[model samples]
Target: MLKANLALLFIILPFTWMISGQFLFSNGDKILVIITVIALITTLFKYGFTPFKKNIINNQYIYLLIILSCISVIYNYFHKSDIINIRSVLCVILYFIFIPLNIISTRVITYSTLIGSIGAISFAFWQKNILHLDRAVWQLNAIPYAACCLILMTAAIILCIIYKDKKEILTISILSAVISFYAIILTETRGVLIAVFSIFLCLFVYVFTTKISVKIKITFITILITIGALGIYTTQNRLIHDTVQGFSQYKQGDDLSNTASRLAMWKAALLLIPQQPISGFGDNFEPAIENLYHENKISSQLYNLHLLHFHNQFIDTTVKHGIIGLVLLLLFVFFPFYILKKTEYSKENKFAIFLLTFGIIISGLTDVPLEHKQVFTLYIVFIYLFLKKTHSVK
Candidate 1:
């Protein structure tokens, strides 16, 4: 009975983020989170925490990162720089526990991820066709929703290549990729588009350079690029026109575009970083900006927006959590690369995980993917899932 409950928890964890927001997520995410956490704790008690060896050091960096996160949470709590929510902080800190608690194999991840992708993609179709919604957010935050679509697209592509022998599955995977790519374009999420397209471009180059037959390679490249070109043409205004406009506006010194606004935010955040270089102004964004405004440090443009993060993940963390937070965040992100580099794995698996992680990192340059709960959970889930199976807790 205990084992069965644990298995169920493993299966449901991924979809918590994939289907979040009003349409399908709502209170459903909270319920899933509750059950998963409970199951994790119960299993830990029953198993006596045998996942780890006696004080052995393997993934110490992960522990350090968690400790730093907890410290920041506590520091913000007593100091009251901006605002502090102990409940949420505890949840973030305890996320590490899930790594050790989940004992399921790679197959569990495979099934759960596929189910989550299908549900999310299905939800996207419902929003677009049934509701006739204009942007097709799947009731998710627009930017993050687009990010999810891109991730699903890449996952489908990976499945298509890996399961090439399975004709039915390959066909379904191709269809899924098409739907995801279409949804990504419809949303007009520029940052995620850049990230996803870059990965595909890399893959395109790889296939061309490989030993594959000239005929097959040419056919594959032609089809993929043709569909991608269609998406580009449809999204020309947001993808091309606005970007060109942003550069022009920036040069004219009367910057008013969204890209210009984000660049301004990054500058403003960086300026404030030196003021509280060590500990930071706490996690409350408004209070920090308020202080900047009082001192005439922030411009009226940035002051009005009252952003939580500077649109860039690194600078965002640095402004609120200080240098320590910035370094820890970087380490946490790059640490996975270290594991992936050393691990013995299939090329497809390595490339798939790299696509996911690299896309998130690139997307973070324009958006704080780690700060948002959904994206944050997405990062944590993929990192641990991609960890080597031999990275034993015992």
Candidate 2:
């Protein structure tokens, strides 16, 4: 019992920050490493090596992908070009760290998420209202900031419903949900807006069908639709205008707009995949884009910038590590959902997994999520915590 309490105490800040600290660059990574070390020590002292064996076996797909990724690194090393992808390697390390983490109670997880939502929205407000920034960017891109806010908002809203019997937690979750929604609006990211509306519709239908009075349900849906419509109305300047403008520019033979650039990169990635179907380009992905430019296969507008990745996660993984890598990435993302289905976990656990899987899939359509360390850590750690069979007890 002492060991369990100690583990929870050590993880509270780091786990909370995982949800809120997408704006942090390297500092978040450092804190994660430190807490992971503490988790490792405490878990070992409490349960020895036996506990590690089962979770590791349960998460075989994740470990398999990590192994293959490391092999790719070694393969690139011998080839003497595109020798390493530090981001991928760092993600692998994060996965390893999460395995030893002791399972935190559901209540702790709920409160931590509440704290995280407040922190995330506070930062967004500071950036937009106080600093007067065009987009709420601080040490991270606005796109990712919006994505993280979406996660916080979704989690908080769901927690509010799950813990509605508890007045204090319910109140905190509601505040987090509201602030988190505002934070997403402040980001001016179109991709996350699509995700937000999608999730909102899904959650609304979920609540509407629940065992509640018809009038209450009607009132709930009315309030939710009002909020959703208002959010969309507020962001029309960026969401609707930019999308229409980008499509119009593309049709007019101009590929300079943000959406057009993403389209071009996706095209280039598809074309490149067939050329290196098995072994990918490793870290020379950008140079391959340049080659396509010189050959007139892609636009010079895309080639001019030092673009770090293809905006889409699947295409980016396919380009970087080929078909095999893409397969592994899919397995890694969907494995938790699969586990939830095959097991009789609690409803809260299942819902957490569903929200995460849905959010990642939706957001990945517009961004490379794992390339960002904070986002990567957030996904892996939560997946482990919520899905761990033995450690979920309060």
Candidate 3:
């Protein structure tokens, strides 16, 4: 049983994530649900619910999010609003699916991340260089594809620094990071560029807090600088030109460029959030945007863009679920840091937690990642696995 679960985690889960999108999330949920049910029944037949109870007690935030989501589901049901919000938040329940398994290894998780990163970048190159797609994507929307690659890239780098003593692993991990970053640039999801900088800042803070040698710290810094330089050099001309043109077009009121559309969406969301600051629109994001359009609060161009969720996660949450949901989302993301301070996990485990959590949060600023079922599952599953390790260490 242990070996089977390890292989599932170390092989199937990571690879599927890199190459597939909706199928990974929807079918992945079904597979995990089956595993959780079987695990629960077998455990109940022997040890009863004590193990599950203990896990639930330890991870209160997950349940809180679940409870909040249930309320949203009910509210949306009655109001005839879209209940898609439930799909993403309810993924937190799958966190429990791993609690009964003892083979959850940070080393396995790190190596699996490397394998997935390699696969994602390779798949992306095939799409761009061979198939000749406009943007390199890991078989999904460019936004989430870039987001996942960012997580994988940063994870590879952090793991490389953590296991720097292992020469072969370090070399592979560095290669994984480089190729994964190159994939990100190819995707051209400009919003995730902020997430790239946010991750480096996190790496710097982690280096200073640890007792590692100065040489390793410097090497990490050098790697980050090289990656940043590579990104800038590869995309400098288009990035600068498109951004300026987009801004100029927006100011002149003849804009439908990428930057302008996002700004318009943000502006519309801001205007609407104040009206429903308590419970929000409750999955009625499209209708609310329509209302803004009818009232002349937003441009017809933006309204015609047919945005389902505001590009910004914070604003999207506030608009859809109101301020309360926004707070819960923040708590869910930053709660790991609280655990990190309270626990004595090793440096690698700690950085893993930090990198993954911040990767989602920062990228979310310019994209509503939590709106996607897959991104939600990915975040909760990995965070719990890492946190479980800390719980044992504690």
Candidate 4:
């Protein structure tokens, strides 16, 4: 009973804090920092720092890579001017806290996480519609939250197909998917839409091509067709309008316009690349990028908005951390896919892992999912758990 409760708390706390942090806390809130500290303490107490254990260590290369990354972070913190970015610091610390806690796996964690995610999605929908909050339209502050939830829901669906579980679990998975998709639609985030669509397309193709039973295949095909039709009707008119508006704004070439501002920001980020090509400017690159925009008189209106990071994740990482950072980031992003490929698991498990890994990689391309503490914490915890599970099977 104690173990079950602890497992439930482990899953609930991280996910709950992640979803609620955006709605309840302001940027750089001490509450978030305090929560991180508490999580770190709990993880240490529960997991007991058994880093030398073979299962926890996993691979020597991973240990070296993580150690080096931590070293880089420490070096940046002490030497770099913008090391005081408390949010970034806390995000890194959370990753450290989560990795060990995830060393021990439990079905309680999985079920609790799924339940919590559903509740969060419901809350997000309520916030958007009943409360009529504009910010809630994006659901969470970051598009990646929606993306992560969608990935998990997709995994749950695959589990339902594979396992001979309770009918209620399967129903819950379907409901979670529906809720996640609804939230994603309201975000109006093109990147997330594209990623979700890509995953659906892949799943459709896989189901159609595979040797699954005719009845199952037909059901999947029917669902796919319905989803596709709905997606097209919903996105066509509004997406076209938004694309045209953005393009027109770009053609007008006004620095203050949204389209032109992003272009200018991209240019400013590029300009910083040559100065610190190897490691860029670390966390301070944002202010420097803004200054470059100001100096060029590219987009004073946008620059004056106190924009801290580039809206684009790839550009942001390249400018801030340089090539080394990019490599480490790539490894973190791609490692899951590599592990999935190695797993000789059941088709359902493989499909689920593939979709989850692909969704994360595609989402990371456009948004800095790793920079947000809530998203980062959830992501690291998931990766750690999934990797541990795979290794245990091996």
Best-matching candidate per lDDT = 2
The predicted structure with the larger TM-score, 3 or 4, is 3
lDDT string, candidate 2, 132-215, tens digits? 877733646778767777777877776676677777777778888888898888887888888888888877877776787898
What local lDDT score does residue 247 receive in model 3, on the 0 to 100 scale? 88
Model 4 over residues 1-394: C-alpha lDDT tens digits? 9975775465345434543343223352355556656655665566655532433344532453356456566857754733123453454444344545333334434454566456556656677778877752444573655655655555555545544245655566566566667666655556667677888888788888888789989997898778857875787654456656766776676546444566666777778877888777876665675567768745666567566666576777778777766776677666666766675455655666566667766776656666665555455545544444332210
Clash list (residue pairs), candidate 2: none
Among the numbered candidates, top TM-score falls to 2
Q: Estimate each model's TM-score.
A: 0.77, 0.84, 0.81, 0.76
Q: Between 2 and 4, whose TM-score is larger?
A: 2
Estimate, for each residue in 66-100, the C-alpha lDDT of model 1 and write its tens digit. Answer: 56566656776765642222333344334444434
Question: Which stretches of model 4 miss by more than 4 angstroms?
Answer: 1-54, 57-65, 78-110, 136-144, 161-168, 235-238, 255-260, 294-297, 338-350, 388-394
Alpha-carbon error at 241 in model 1, in Å? 1.0
How would you order the candidates by lDDT, starting with the best?
2, 3, 1, 4
lDDT of 3 at 342: 85
lDDT per residue for candidate 3 within 155-191, as digits (tens), equals: 6776576667777667777887887788888777777
For candidate 4, the per-residue lDDT at 83 reads 18
Which residue pairs in candidate 3 collide? Answer: none
RMSD of 4: 4.9
The reply for model 1, stretches above 4 Å from the true place, is 1-29, 41-72, 78-111, 122-139, 166-172, 211-216, 250-256, 285-298, 389-394
